[model samples]
Target: MFCASLADVFDNSVDLAWRADLWALVRDTPHLDWLVLTKRIGNVSAMLPADWGCGYGNVWLGISVVSQDEADRDIPKLLCLPAAVRWLSLEPLLGSVSLQSATGPFGETLDWAVVGGESGPHARPMKAEWVHDLRAQCGTLAIAFFFKQWGGHENGK
Candidate 1:
């Protein structure tokens, strides 16, 4: 959904797939602040309002990067946007992923990177090395990096 309505609360467990159904409504709404972008593999900006350039309060743009392969494809696309704040939703992190060599025109627009492990009955184990890699990258790039959790029995603190 777009950042013009506060109707949606993000819950990874939700099975709803991303689409253009909520685009028009967000464009018409003025009280929206956050936009949570998620999907298998597609362009989220393509469904947004053409006039929704950027500089809106709390208007965040994020995309799910499940693996290194998806990261290669999604992060670049997300970076190309003109959103006020851009972020990565690395949930259900299945394997090691890094953007060290994926530089491009859009890479410079990145503002935040969130790293987290899968939760629930099928929770997967996350290696500390992977988290460290992201932390190092974010530090080097001056981007915000947040560790959501460690999943399983490991405390993320």
Candidate 2:
């Protein structure tokens, strides 16, 4: 399940009570694996549930990274946290990102990487080479790579 697809679950503006309620719902639904993607990776440590000692077994935590700068800044933060699965959502990819140097605690690498281009009337162009490069990097690292789309189109490349 993609939790809070249109909203940031870790957004500072969201009410704490509402977040608690969402956590409760997550706890109740043990059979479903929740994929929580957030741009505010920094807020996660403080907002997680009390029982999130090593993260929930059913939760796959991910962060949305658009450029190399954001990747450098946020990926490390996400890596520091404990999650059943750590992944990246490179949607609306505006720049090239090389994950060759990104390593997590205990020499861990990202479990998954979803790559896609911007889509919409004013969607920016995504270079095919960029996608190819990322795919190759993920392959070399043995991380699961999912090519979601090429810019200006809905179908995967």
Candidate 3:
């Protein structure tokens, strides 16, 4: 399950005591693979719990890569951090991104990538070729790819 869905867990505004409580729960729930996505990838090292040796087996870290500039800047940071699974989320995909495709512990570039267009009244449209290109890149590097949506004002079953 995703924690801090509406707020950033890395936000300094959140009390340290509260985060400690959450970490305690995360430690107890070994059966759940906590998928944590953050825009604050830079804050991870300093904020990590003392028990986070190398990385936690149950936690998967994902970072946002909205555009080429961000991908270039953030992907490298993620590469240095150890995790069971390191993924990229190109959601609300703004433009074509040259991920350049790096690798994981076992040589997989990305454990997975989730691609999706923006969704809202003024949602921006995304191109099929963009998705195709990202999928191709992942395929070439042996990374898993998941297409979340074409996206629109309406989201229904």
Q: How high is each candidate's TM-score?
A: 0.72, 0.94, 0.90
By the lDDT metric, which is better: model 2 or model 3? 2
| Model 1: per-residue Cα lDDT over 106-145, one tens digit each | 4455678888887788677877788888888888888789
Whichever of 2 and 3 has more TM-score, that candidate is 2
Residue 92 error, candidate 3, Å: 0.6
Clashing pairs in 1: 4-32, 5-32
Best-to-worst order by TM-score is: 2, 3, 1
Q: CA lDDT, every prediction?
A: 0.66, 0.90, 0.80
- lDDT ranking of the models: 2, 3, 1
In model 2, what are the clashing residue pairs, if there are any? none
lDDT of 3 by residue, 1-157 (tens): 7877677777777789887887788889989988888889899877778888867888888897888888888888887787778888898887887668465345545688899988888888787778889999889877789999978733321
> TM-score for model 1?
0.72
Candidate closest to the true structure, highest lDDT: 2
lDDT of 2 by residue, 1-157 (tens): 9999999999999999999999999999999999999999999999999999999999999999999999999988988998999999999888789895569767766989999898889888888878888999998888899988886854433
Superior candidate under TM-score, 1 versus 2:
2
**lDDT for 76 (candidate 1):** 72
The lDDT, on a scale of 0 to 1, for candidate 3 is 0.80
Backbone collisions counted per model: 2, 0, 0
